[model samples]
Target: MMAATNNKEPQRIHPHKFTLWVAMGSIIMMFAGLTSAYIVKRSQSNWLEFSLPFVFWYSTATIIISSITVQLSLKAFIAREMKQYRTLIGITAFLGVLFISLQLVGFYNLESRGIPLFGVKSNSATSFLGIITGLHIVHVLAGVIAILVLFIKAYFSKIKNYSSVPLEIISTYWHFVDILWIYLFIFFNWPR
Candidate 1:
């Protein structure tokens, strides 16, 4: 047996970013399992099919905008524009809260239309929707908390670290969550 003889330099990645990638892969796997179960269960009897709430479109737009702002924040920080970076981070955090609010409103809109998420009347479709969306919201909230931490650090730290790693990690996570929402939105609305 010939030993492997190829020598190639390995690219180095920040440890925190590598950890985040692993966590994101895990999240993707979990969501894939849930959605796959949703598809299989959908083919069964009593699977209720209804239109998604209109507020979902608004929520989608909000999250997309937040992703942009997060990118802007990183750029500002890298440019050493402290004021602009702080402003962008604040906006991103606000948009995060707004997105969660919109999600809750969408849920309420569904329930008001006789599509209960949890109850004796709840169907598998709505139940899966609630679970999937609720989990996504939890992740979004985490992103928001990360934003706040960055914001506070930007505001109050007497010593200047000037490292972009924290902001870059948050930006990546924010973008991932945004992309995940887009995928879920399309998954829910795609015609059968």
Candidate 2:
């Protein structure tokens, strides 16, 4: 008779990964509600329509490029190309900052046109734009912080086993934010 076999199925997701997924789901739901409200409010008589600033287009491109760099960084990490990984991560972080700066320029452009984010004269359209884009910026800031942490850890060789978990998580989050921004940009620009 053979001894009992100790077979185990692979764990597909880590606990931290599960937690991140749950958080992402909540965020999706929140944005869905916000966008739904935005659509419903658009038919109101006082809704203001304004063209988005040109800088927003530049920021959109910046975020898309950052997404590519983050993916490259992940691939480099998996291949154990530490130097390339570090450089890609650094570039991604810089792009994150650039995206934020461009977004600020967009906000300034709106304000210059007298579309303030909040005030008696501020219509729902401008307010929604501010709230939605501001929330996205906060998420991007969190992603940038995570990238910086990973970059620092990689720089100091703190990632002892060359584990891909942290990099994978960061990449997933970065991609999510990138896609979310793209969706928002399209949603805002779409004809009502």
Candidate 3:
């Protein structure tokens, strides 16, 4: 009897890419736990219903723009357009900063409206809102840092033909954070 031999080699993900995915999974689980807790706590007592900060809309817009720029940067990199890649990545980084700034402003705006953002003064709903959004901000900031590092590497290094893996990773994470914000925005606005 003759047997056919398989010729295809299994492709493996980059270690760094695998690590990022694992971290993202852990983050998703954590946020799920938090939202679940918020849902449970809502039924208990002292759940203050309030409008989401308006500045969050601006921040959401900024993050969405940043995601687009990061994606364009990746495409530019793939096309070997160093100048365009640099410019797009720079825009992405700027938008990331803008998003974070808007988030802080939104926090301040909430405080101005007498909604306690953090600490002992906060109620269940406000506290959960603060914690969840704060965690998301941290994740977005991590993505921003990654973008800035890549941007710097692109400019400061002598190598013109840089690898696209870093850009791809950054773009993926940036998109993830952007999508996460969209999910959260819809979640907070959902009718009870």
Candidate 4:
């Protein structure tokens, strides 16, 4: 008797989606740890109660807008509209840069008010906030780098047939990071 052969094809998991899930999970863990620490320490003595920097709200809005633009880019790519995709990608890249700039401005504003966003160590609370925001800022910088790489790939590469997967992954990761920041901002602003 001849050996039976199965005709079923293996389902291919998109590598980009897998990567996005991994990146999002890592981001969630990072922010989860930070927020947990924030709550635990806020309950402790000598936790300086201060108003969160207003610029954080602005930065949050900007990042949310950027997420939308990135989604738009992915949709355009899926529709095979190269021109719209390119334009949206460029817009998303610029928004990422703008978000970083806003974050920097927020740090500066906080420091000008003596709130130690960039390494002010007056107390444990300040230190914690400084470190938490700093770490998140570093993550934001990584997102910016990822977007820049995406922009370059979309512009210079000739692999136009199936190049949108990477962008889709990066976009999802970027949006996840943005939402994480909003969650953090709310947690930090919550009254004890």
C-alpha RMSD of each candidate structure in angstroms: 4.4, 2.3, 2.0, 3.4
Q: Give lDDT tens digits, candidate 3, residues 1-192.
A: 889999899999999899889998999999999999988988875789899888888888899888889999999999989899999999999999999899889889888998887788878798898899999999988988989998898889877656788888888889999998999998998998
Between prediction 2 and prediction 4, the one with superior TM-score is: 2
Off by more than 4 A, model 4? 1-12, 118-121
CA-lDDT, candidates in order: 0.97, 0.92, 0.89, 0.79
As for lDDT, the candidate ahead, 3 or 4, is: 3
After superposition, candidate 2 runs with Cα above 4 Å error: 1-10, 157-159
Once fitted onto the true fold, the runs of candidate 1 whose alpha carbons sit more than 4 angstroms away are: 1-11
* Candidate 2 structure quality by residue, lDDT tens digits, 1-192: 989987988768898888899999998998999999999999999889888998999999999999999999999989989899999999999999999999999999999988898788788899999999999999999999999988888778643877898889989999999999999999999987
* TM-scores of all candidate predictions against the true structure: 0.94, 0.93, 0.94, 0.86
Top candidate when judged by lDDT against the true structure:
1
Q: After the best TM-score superposition of candidate 3, give how far the Cα of residue 70 lies from its true spot, in angstroms.
A: 0.4
* Candidate 4, pairs of clashing residues: none
**Model 1 TM-score, all chains together:** 0.94
Worst 10 residues of 1 by lDDT: 2-11
User: How many clashes in each structure?
Assistant: 0, 0, 0, 0
Candidate 4 lDDT over 1-192, as tens digits, reads 999999999988797697768877886887788778877877878777887778878888888898998899899988888789888888887887888788788767777887774343666687777787777778777878888877787789876666666777788778877887787788778777
Which of 1 and 2 is ahead in lDDT?
Answer: 1
